[model samples]
Target: MPPTRPSAVPPQGDTGARADAYATAPLLNCLLREVARPVPGAGEPRVYRLPSGERLLRVRGGRRPAAPEVNAGGTWHRVGHAELVKLVAEELQAHTGLSNPELPAEMADSRDAVAALLTARDRTTPPDDPYRRSEQSLLTGHPYHPAPKARGGGPVAAWLPYAPEAYAAFPLVLLGVREDAVAEEGDVSALDAFGTAPPGYQLLPAHPWQLDLVGPSLTDAFADGRLIRLGTTAFDTWPTAAIRTLYAPEHDLFVKFSLDVRITNDVRRLWRHDLLKLRRTNTAVSAAAPSVTPGAWLSDRGYRTADFAFEELAVLVRDGLHTHLAPGTTPLLAAALVESFDDTPLDGLHDPAAWWTAYLRAVVPPTLELFARHGVVIEAHLQNCLIAVDATGTPVQALFRDAEGVKLLPEVSRAAGWERLVYCLVVNHLVEIAEALCERHPDLDPWPAVRTAFERQSLRLDLPEATALLTAPTLPGKTNLLLRWTGADGADARYLPLPNPLRAR
Candidate 1:
């Protein structure tokens, strides 16, 4: 189907096609990553050996992987998204004897959410700005996550307005927190500039989704004048891939709010412990970031919240893209750079080899530098990093964010921190990107550039782990399937070794 223009509605048939494609990608990713082993050599309908001996599974290939089938009775029986979820559930129950009633619904909800997004977007206009387009472009998120697109099982009417994929932009709902109840650290004064607060109150901006979730509980606070409805910011903010985080392009600032929704693995809440350590972690990373490159860390400067309703009303203020962005360059989401975008810098590359090299340079150096020189373990996953491109859309710089995700060295044992860094930086970040480049330009070999990027970096000589990374036979791949099935904390990442393509040929 052709791309739908703004104010145009796609035919019902096209919506279903898009929905299946969007929904199945994550399901296939989960199945292949957790239970299926390759059939060694298979054509078109790629075959895999399921855990239950001799039984085979087949799927159409692509980054997303689609059209799954199980070979039985000398025929391939097709499995739609619902059947796939059941298959996964049955398989997990047999494997672990664990039955999660919640996860299955979430899986179904994720697919339903995609169908709704497809249906809604057909009638709406995609963002015209390149940055906004890239930010709103993720239809299939966290490619390996089982229910990456799930919106906490909320109704389409409740969550669709806030979904980034639907090109959501809205003014932040502002509130006045009584001065005595306001507890903040570092620089949150920037938030106050969004709106005015009366003499004894401070401004607190909230994500509307979060407000919807927690508003009923705040009745007493409102009744007692502890919280006052001060209306919304004058301008609208774009929701980034991190749903709770909003970018106010007009002010060039970002506001991170505590949301109760479970996106991907974790309930998107600003935990009290994380809020307390926010300034320390941000300071450490900010101090380390500058030494690495012109690329920067948007400091999670500070937060504002009521002591009574702390995490519920908490908001973290961070620097915007403009200050950290390289001059004259357009910044794009790093994850979106890998996704299929109409005018992504990765599109129609004249020299993919050079572009991949530049991508490695812009992204890798700063990440490794923070780990080696400063003991800062950046969760330098694709989503956390942004690639800035020049006028012609060649990548020029990399910017990193999210203090909550960073693990400071010595704070976490060196070995433990390095493992997390490897999973996030190489397995989660670089590997997918390499595949994306290969997918875009099939004839091009992306690994040699990857091998060179890590092998020749001077910092690797200082950090012993970097040397091992290039020649290492395997890298740690996060087991998102098993994690969710076993009900583990999202941060408590369990990794299974994956074949390392960065090895010397």
Candidate 2:
């Protein structure tokens, strides 16, 4: 990682067009040029900064268009366009419990329409009846909303991007309350009942972001922890303003916000901290084996940056796809090792050493090249990545989180930031995993796999950039994961020697 800087700066909603009002809108371009300049007819729109540092423009007179009077089951409530956005925000916060609710382009219209649209979005799903019929409002209590499940109940629908369909969010409301309770009583303790805290990992004192999920109970938890030594107002780069909730009923499951310069420097540092925490959590989770599954990602509630509060909602599975490497699980380390040595793994084929080879090949090159590609880059270190596996011994998923690691393509930022991304993602993450894989699978080659991954991902890069990523040929030291340098003639293979077994004894 580049020399760590002590500090830094700042940084949605659904659109109405596609899914309905409650749907996430398209990303609005914040460029000043994109802003509609005031003219004769349209009033000067109100500009507000979102939590992520993006800007929101409200047309001064933009009202939610009036709906035609209908003799329908439910009456259409009249509201303004901006009020619609606010309601959407409130509803999202109410449902998803994320800190900020985004409004994309499609949802940016009048009030009554937005509300009707939001209602329609939820109503589109099939109701949970014996026949599994479709209904507009499946889960009652709050507003008439979509039902995530069909009556017979196969599997819930996949949550959508932008405008969040009420999959997980709506479930929080379903926890403990009656169908009508959500509608009448705003409090949603009905669902919080199901969220059992993992053994020893007591729920950390929640920040405001988690208000919707944990309910008011967090306030009590915080006060108790503070009165004792357990709770702390320590800063995680943000003067303790950013509350990190931990469920260490047994072990530490780190909870922190995504990067937001406006909120505090901690947001930017979250990736690194989380990585460290994941490692720690993994060790703890492993120790408690029979009781707790080795968990990784925890939910991130509310995080406010400059103008808006970004809401994060999700129950993360720790590298669910790549968990074979966990303790007691058998992994084909030999195949992983071979892949790290070269680029021969991504051909839709598998090798015992596929994991190792792929790591060295793909992870390292992109990381090292990031600096030259842009001035300010991102770090794709270990914490941001999630390695997963399927039933059979095979690599299935490699989920990368913490968008903060995505550096500005050098042209956008600077060498300082850009290089951090390269170092963190490629060198730090890929290399370590490659090393671990190599330790397990010695027979497989990592070289070809490394080469193959670079060739695939680097399809858009130039030769030099490509070469920088594939810097294996230039590294020094036999034990060094990246074969940085192989001498003038590129003579012979020089691998790191095995350690003396006697040393352990």
Candidate 3:
């Protein structure tokens, strides 16, 4: 049977073209990286041979590849987002010796989601603060995931108002859980600052979207008075790149909630297991913060939830920028540097090499030293990192966050942990930044500066893994596309070796 197409037709005019472009870049990136072998030739448009079905594919541009075409019947034909999804489905099934009905649908849903976001963005005004704008600028998220923008296949109306890409900000629903039923740990006192609870209750803020999702499950809790609706917060919280996490600028606080939506790979819930381990993880990362120096760690301070609905209604309090950020330095999401935005530091870069070197200095030392000295493996991917730039748009400091994704040493074998670090730091973080910079300044070679940064850190920290990284022929590249297609755990990261740019030519 031919593949099923997405329900929503592509939007009309320039919006349609833009939706296609935004959606196609990441899907093409995944296909090219994981499954397609480069065809030996250089020209205006690059070509690749899909080994699974022996099909030929071509695309123009680098960094964010666009205008995809497939060769069939002795001619190359342009393929839109829907057709691209079909082609990916066919290639994956053939390549993996497996079939997946869900992924194709998700790919379609993701494309449709982009269209919705583009439309919503037209009507909304982006945040005035550059930092907030950077935080919300991930239009094409997770550059290698097939359905990075997929919103659990829900209606646009259901999710659009809360979408960060659409510059969304709204008040969080406040609930009062009976004191006896409240389960919490550490410094969750930050949550109580939102609003007051009645005589026998405690304040618990919940993501309105999450409440909409798990409302049915909490019906009895509400009926029995375990949970009471106390109305929404008076102030608004801007949704961050991580949709489940929101930033309350008024309070200078970040609150993460258990969203039962499948974003990217996992159902993004504050899982019981992760929450149980949250204190231990946060403590360890906090203790390791000194090793990063001027670079800092945004510790997940604590979490709060009702015992009856632990995972469904749980909320985590994270350290906000005001406390951790250096005086006068502006923190920009690291992902935004690669994704690009209005007035992004990279946009007006006068010296690409110097800018990149400063970036490496801010980001690399902290990531490696934590692993080497403190035995902390932070998931220092772009989203989890914030690069604080000075007034002149030069990167001055790096701040890392998300304890839920942090892995400590000894708990994980050194080898396993090192591999994870390399993938997250080098492949996921540095490669994207370098490519984006090089794309902008084609005359500059970003890798040598990267190599120097790594070598200097290896010597400074005496990290053997860092030394080995320089000579290594291949870097571990996460296979996001195949992982999703095979229905693997999102945490169960499988890597394919890509030619290491750090290695001397």
Best by TM-score: 3
> Whole-model lDDT for model 2 versus the true structure?
0.29
Q: Write the per-residue lDDT of candidate 1 for residues 1-505, one digit (tens) a residue.
A: 2222111112246666666667778777777877778887798778987765546788876666877888756788988778888888877777787889888888988888888987777788888899888888887788889898999887899989988989999999999999999988889889878999999998899888899999999999999999999998899998998988999988899889998988889998999999999989999999888788856788899998999998999999989887788899988898886675668776668998988888888988888888888899988898898889999888889999999999997989998999999898888888888877777678988888877777666555487787888888888888888899899997788888888888877
TM-score of each: 0.96, 0.30, 0.96
How good is model 1 by TM-score? 0.96
**Candidate 2 displacement at residue 409 in angstroms:** 3.9
Tens digit of lDDT per residue, candidate 2, span 40-84?
A: 442344333223222233322111111211111234334433444
lDDT of 3 by residue, 268-379 (tens): 9999999999999999989879757768998899899999999999999998999888889999999988775778777757888899988999999888899989999999
The worst-scoring run of ten residues by lDDT in candidate 2 lies at 2-11
State the TM-score for model 2: 0.30
Best candidate according to lDDT: 3
The alpha-carbon lDDT assigned to residue 503 of candidate 1 equals 87
Candidate 3: clashing pairs of residues: none
Segments of candidate 1 deviating more than 4 angstroms: 1-12, 458-461
Better of 2 and 3 by lDDT: 3
Task: Please give the lDDT score at residue 369 for candidate 2.
Answer: 41
